[model samples]
Target: MKKSLVLAMVLAGFAATSFAAEPAFLADRHVARGASCESCHGVKAPAPGAKVSSTACMNCHGSLDKVAERTKAKVPNPHYNHLIGTDCQECHKGHAQSVNLCGSCHNLDWKVP
Candidate 1:
């Protein structure tokens, strides 16, 4: 009984620490400037396990056409020939490391940051 109780306390402490260490979205430059959770999430706090939609990002970042055009000269267009369409969050995570979704299938050496 003591062992079980001790284990539960340790697990609870670890869970609390993990939650406290989570990075805040407000740490991002866009959010620091003026953007709020509502800007992307449309709520003060999203429901547990809720996800922000691509449209929420597009509202500020503009359409896929605009993104493709802007990046056409500098880099290979991830937006244009994407197999998964323009779900920006697939590569453009605001609060975490951005990934190049194209890297999953193609060997394109494009650096997505």
Candidate 2:
């Protein structure tokens, strides 16, 4: 029992340390990608016309259909709704932070009860 408890404690400590280290790894990749995120998202609020950005990124993302499949795990209507007005950074968060950044604009109207 004591041995199992100590092993669990050690694993938990490693997970905590790795979580702290994750941001640095993400930043390195963001730098290699060679663009400031703000060049796109901007201070102005997003609009439906923002679909332009999706088309631009998809040109290089290899297969838009594949990304749609993966993102649908987090967002159901990737084509018609979730990806419509938001910036790629709003949800993707590059390498550092992850989760739905769309809450910045969406928090008021969209919510789960």
Q: Which candidate has the highest lDDT of all?
A: 1
- RMSD of each candidate? 9.6, 8.4
| Poorly placed runs, candidate 2 (over 4 Å) | 16-60, 78-85, 102-113
**Which structure among the candidates has the greatest TM-score?**
1
Which consecutive 10 residues in model 2 have the weakest lDDT in total? 104-113
**Candidate 2 lDDT tens digits, 1-113:** 69999999999999998866544433344444663444343424445444225544555564556665655655444434645655554455444454544455665333211
Q: Which residue pairs come into collision in candidate 2?
A: none
Q: Score candidate 1 by TM-score against the native.
A: 0.66
Per-residue C-alpha lDDT of model 1 across residues 1-113, encoded as one tens digit per residue: 69999999999999898766654442275665778878888789877676788888789879888878888775456777735466777777777777777877778776665
Candidate 1 residue 36 Cα shift, in angstroms, is: 0.9
TM-scores across all candidates? 0.66, 0.41
lDDT values, one for every candidate: 0.73, 0.51
Q: Judged by lDDT against the true structure, how good is candidate 1?
A: 0.73
lDDT of 2: 0.51
